[model samples]
Target: MKNRTILLTGGGTAGHVSLNQALIPELKNLGFNVEYIGSKDGIESGLIPDSFPDVPYHAIASGKLRRYFSVKNFTDPVRVGAGLVQALNVIRKTKPVAIFSKGGFVSVPVAMAGKLMSVPVIIHESDVTPGLANKIAMPFANHIFTVFKETLKHVPKEKSTCTGSVIRSELMDGSAAKGKEICNFNNDLPVLMVMGGSQGSAVINEAIRSNLTALLKQYNVIHLCGKGNADSSLMDLANYKQFEYVTHELPHLLHMTDFVVSRAGSNSIFEFLALKKPMLLIPLSKLKSRGDQILNARLFQQQGFAHVVEEEELTPERFLAEMQKLQMDEDLLVDAMTNAESPKTAYEMAKLVAAHTKN
Candidate 1:
C-alpha cells in the first residue's frame, strides 16, 4: 500500500506558510497524514504548531539565498547542506509519498531532499515571476503550480499548471461586526486597514504613523505594524487600533475594512481581490526584492483592481493622493474584482495536490 503521508515545506515569511496552513486541514480531511518541515526560526515554526497542534513539525537548518554579496553567503551553503541532511532524515522517517512546497528559502533543501529520495516534489509559486528559491527548486520538482499564468513563462511550462490563488476558507466567513468589535470602533467612519505584509514594512509604518492624525480625521485605522514596530504612544488613541501581528483575527479585520493599504504580495493582493476590497498597493522596491511585488502590483493596477504606488515614490503626499484615488475608484475596482476569475478553494487545491501523490 502507498504511504498515506505528505510533507509540506516552506517559510521565511508568512506568505510561504499561509498556503500550507490553508492546506493542512484539507489534506488531513482527505485522509492523508500531513507533516511540516521548515526552518527552526522561520515564522512557520511557530505558526504551524500554534494553528495545528496535532500535526508534527520538523524544524531544519536553513539559510537565506541571496544574490548580493554577503559575508554569510559562504557560510549559508553549509547550512543548506545541513538542512538537506536533516530533511532527508525526516523524509526517511516519515516516508511521505509526496512533498508539497510553497516557495521560500527554507524549502530549497527540502525539495532537493525529496528529489534525492525519489519522492515526488511539487512547488507552488504565488508571484507573477518565480522567486529565487522556487527557481532553484524547480528542476528538482516533479511539477510546479503557479498562482499567475504569467509565471509559466519563467518556469518549465511542461510540468507547470496555473492553479490560480487558493484562498483560506475561513477568511470568507469573517464577521464584519466582530471585526469592528475587535477594534473597538463604530460605524461612524469608514475603516481603513493598513498592512505591510507578514513581517511589516518600516517605510509603510512610518508613512501611516506620520499621517495617523490626518487619517483618523476621516477613517478609523487598523494597522498591522509588524512585530516590535508598534508605538506605545498610539495605543490609547481612539479611531485607531494597532497590532504587531494577527492570525485568526485577520479575516474579521479584512471583512470590516472599507479600504486597504498593503504591500503587493501575491497572496495578499489576491485576498483583497477576492474580497472585492478597493486597495492601494505599495510594492516593495527593486532594491529590496527581485521586483516580484512590482509585477504583482502592476498587473492588479492594469486590471483596475488596485492603485499602485511604487515604494520609491511613496511620499506622504503621494500616499494620501493614492488613497483618495482608490476611494474614488472603489466601485470600478470592486466591479473588476467581481468579474475576475475566482480563486480555487482550499479543498479543490488539496485534491489537486493529493492527485499527484505516489500510489
Candidate 2:
C-alpha cells in the first residue's frame, strides 16, 4: 500500500470536504500516498491544504451544478468541459491506484477521467438521496458508498453500499473542561451548540438572537455562526459566545454540548448523533434547496435520533418548544445513539478503497 498513491477529490462545501478529511488519516495509516484534486477556489482548496499539509494538492477548473435557471448555467458547461481536460491531464501524470471522491461538482470530471484512465473510482454520497453531482458521477464510479441505509435504493444496487457516515476520531477527543474554558461557560448550565453548516444560516442565527434571553435562562450557548455572521453587539452577553467558526476547537465544543440546535446537513447531524447529542433539526426548506436536508431531518426523527422543525415553521417559540421536548427525551436519544449500529464504518470504507486499489 505504501507504493500506492490514491487520488481524492471533493469540494464546494465542508460536507463534501470533511468526509475526505476524516478518511485521510486512516488512509495514511494504511500506508497509502494521498493526493487531493479540488477546484482552484472551492472551500476544499482552502481547507485540504491546511488539514493535509503532507498530501500533494492539485487544483482544477470546476463549475457549479445548479438546479435553477441562471446566467451562470450558460457558461458552466464550458467550465465543466475544461475541467474534464484538466482532470485527465492530472490523472495521466499521477496514475493513482484508485480515486475516491466525496462528490462535489469538482469530483465529476475527476471520476470521468479515472474511468477513461482505467483507474477504479469510488464515491461517497452523504445525503439520504444522491446529490446532483453524485448522480452525474455515478456512471463513472465503480463503487458508491452511502451514509444512510435508505440511500441505497436510489442508486444502482450493484455499485452502492450503505457504509454509514465517517465520524472523525478527532471529534471524539474534545474535552468538556477545555470546551468550558474556551467558551467561558460554566458547568452549572447545560451547553447548547448551534451550527448552521460552514456558511451559517441566517434564519438560525436570527432565531437564536431573538431568543437569547429565554434560551440563556436554561443553557449556555456556543454559536458557530459562520464567516461574517457574528454579531458584535452580542459579545458582552454572559452565558453566550459566538465564533465565525472553529478549526481545532470543534471537538472540544462538541464535548461541551449537552444538546444541539442545527441545520439538517447529513455530515453535521451524523457527527452530532455519533456523540449522542440530542438535536432539534431545522432543515433547509424546499424553497431554498433540493429538499435533501428535509429528508435528512425527517429520517433522523423517524430513527429517534432527533426532532425536526421545518425552516418555514422554525420561529424562536417553536424552536424553544422543540428544545424543551428534546431535553426531556435526552436520555432516549442517547440510548438510541448508543445502540446504533455504525461502528467502524469509516475504517471499513477505507479498507474497501484499499482493496479496490489492488484491483
**How much lDDT does each candidate structure score?**
0.93, 0.89
Q: Per-residue alpha-carbon lDDT of model 1 for 1-359, expressed as tens digits?
A: 33499999999899999999999999988999999998898899999999999999999999999999999999999999999999999999999999999979999999999999999999999999899999999999999999998988999989999999999999999999999889999658999999998889999998898888789998999999999998999899889899999999999999999999999999999999999999998899999989999999999999989998888888887788888888888899999999999999999999999989988
- In model 2, the runs with Cα more than 4 Å from the true position are none
In candidate 2, how many Å is residue 329 off?
1.8
As a whole number from 0 to 100, the lDDT of residue 85 in candidate 1 is: 98
| Candidate of highest TM-score | 1
Q: Enumerate clash totals for all models, in the order shown.
A: 0, 0
CA lDDT, candidate 1, residue 207: 86
Write down the TM-score for model 1.
0.98
TM-score of 2: 0.97
The collision pairs in model 1 are none
lDDT tens digits by residue: candidate 2, 16-49: 9987888888888898888999999999998999
